[model samples]
Target: MRIVAIANQKGGVGKTTTAVNLGAALAELGRRVLIIDLDPQANATSSFGLQGVEDISLYEPLLGGALVTEKIFPTQREGLFIVPADLDLAGAEVEIARMPNHLTRLAETLKPLQEDETFDFVFLDCPPSLGILMSNALAAADELLTPIQCEYFALEGLVKIVRLVEQVRDSGANKRLELAGIVMTMFDGRTNLSEQVVAEVRQHFGERVYETVIPRSVRLSEAPSFGKSILEYAPSGAAAQAYRALAREFIQRHSPPAARALEAPEQ
Candidate 1:
């Protein structure tokens, strides 16, 4: 399985939204996708309509005793599954810090699934901070998918995350970790500021930025409150179509040969 961590230290950059909706879009394309909500707020978990399942959350496995697979819960989408999280995860940083080989806890927890091929793709919704949780995710992930907001401060946040990714790779925690792509979110074509931000990010990152930018939409923001992805909540909306296009582009760029083989027959 290809493990991709969707993270951005800046809040409201559409990190959780991408993890939830992109996973749904990928699932719609016939890939079994698993989303692991590592954020204390658990917004990604709730996005899938899995609220009130606090008893079994990612907190248990992060403590290093529970099996990661056992925490998996089915979501409303058939091929999309999730490992929920809750407020209890807020204390995990302190607990994980005291453990031996602390940064590797999550990686070890997920090793079994990597071997078994439990899901074709696993997306981790990391916390919005440079803390233990984020470090653990960087250590475990094969690739990083950062979502940058189309705002004035977008480059500042992106630089910090890019530096962190470099440190994680240099520290030997996960040398194979690389950037999958950068996505610009909340884009407004009508706003000169948004267009300028996208242009600046593209100039800096070049081809690393995705061409399918996520536009600001009422429907996208409302989907999470209704406990559904954009695809299920408003399939015909612009945001839904944007995510669908992203899924296809993402697969073409990142899908492994085995996964591509599966898609070939369908095409």
Candidate 2:
């Protein structure tokens, strides 16, 4: 299984949106997917119609209170699941900081799933901050998938997050950590600025950036408000098709480690 942290410290960059929609799209393609909403905003949780949830979050798990599996809640989708987040998680950073192996606490908590192979992919929907929660998410992830908006400042923010990922790798907490991919979102086909930003990102990251650019779709933005993914909300829309394409491309790029290991020649 692949543990991917869908993170971008800058808000409104479609980070959580990618996590939610991508998880749904992957599940639609017969992959077992789980999204751990690490944001206090709980946008991911509410995006799936799970509201006013209590004691069913990762707050207890990260603090040594309960196992993460116990907090796992199934969404309406068959193969998709979620570990919801609430306001309590905002306060968890302080308490988590005082704990032993704070950075790896999330990793340690998630070790069981890594062993059980419970899901094909576990996407961490991180908050827009550089706090303990974000640190723990990076430390626990096998790879980081950041969603960059198609805007003027996207490149600068991408550099910062890439540098942070490098730091997380060098820390030895998760030496396997790498930048999995960069997803371009909020793309306006009518704007030259959008094309320019995508060009600049591809210039720097080359093949690390995804080819499927998520366009600025009103239906995509409205899906979350109604507690649904783009696929469920407007499956035939351009946004939904884009995410589905992304899921296909993602599967091609991020094959399970065991599969990759099997493919590696004896050396």
Candidate 3:
């Protein structure tokens, strides 16, 4: 399975939105997808109309207290599942501060799934901060996908994330965690500024920037308010189409890993 962490240290950049929509879009394409909402806000969890907190959550599992499987819950959509989050996760930063190897807790918890080949793709929606939660998510991921908003601040904030990725690499917490790609979100075609931002990011990242740019559509913003993805809320809208294109881009880029492995000679 290919695990991806949709992360950015900046808030309101469509990070959770990309997580929910891309997960849904991949599921729609006949791939088994799981979304692990690492954000304490639980926006990814709430986006699917799920808001429950009894015992199990990322907080419990990462604290080395609960099994990861125990926190997994089926979402409203078929082929899509989520390991929901809760308010308790907000305290994890403080709680894990005193613990050893805290940054690798998420990677340890996800080991079983990776070994057993449980799902086709796992998307981690990290919190908008450079805290323990984000570290754990980064350490556990195979690749990091950053959703850049079409604005001036987007590139400025991205430099910090690049530095964090470099730190993770130097620390050897998942040396394979590469910069997967960047998706430009909330794009406005009418604005030259939006076009310039996209051009600049693409110039910096080169092929790491995706061809699919998510437009600033009202439907994309409105879906989460109703606890749904654009696909479920307005499947025919530009936002949904953008998400579909993203899924296609993701699969097209990473599907080779599976195929190449299958073709390798047996030991």
TM-score of each model, in listed order: 0.94, 0.95, 0.94
In candidate 1, the residue pairs with backbone N, CA or C atoms under 3 Å apart (3 or more residues apart, or in different chains) clash, namely: none
Q: For model 3, where is the 10-residue window of minimal lDDT?
A: 48-57
Clashing pairs in 2: none
Clashes found in each candidate (C-alpha, N, C closer than 3 A): 0, 0, 0
| lDDT preference between candidates 1 and 3, better one | 1
Residue-level lDDT of model 3, residues 1-267, one tens digit each, is 988999998888999999999999999998889999998889898888787764557888878887888888887788899998898888988888778888888889888788777799899999998898889889999999999899987778778888888999999887888887899999999999999999999888889999999999988878987888899999998889999999988888886688857756799
Residue 52 shift from truth in candidate 1, angstroms? 2.1
Whole-model lDDT for model 1 versus the true structure? Answer: 0.90
- Cα RMSD (Å) between model 1 and the true structure? 2.6
lDDT by residue (tens digit), candidate 1, 178-252: 876999999998989999999999999998999999999999989998998999899998999999999998888
Q: Lowest lDDT 10-mer window, candidate 1?
A: 258-267
lDDT of 2: 0.92
- Give the Cα error of residue 255 in candidate 2, in Å: 2.7
The Cα local distance difference test for each model comes to 0.90, 0.92, 0.88
Rank list by lDDT: 2, 1, 3
State the number of backbone clashes in model 1.
0
Candidate 1, residue 258: how far the Cα is off, in Å: 11
Candidate 2 per-residue lDDT, tens place, 90-158, comes to 889899898878899899889879888779999999999999999999999989999999999888998
Question: By lDDT, who's the top model here?
Answer: 2
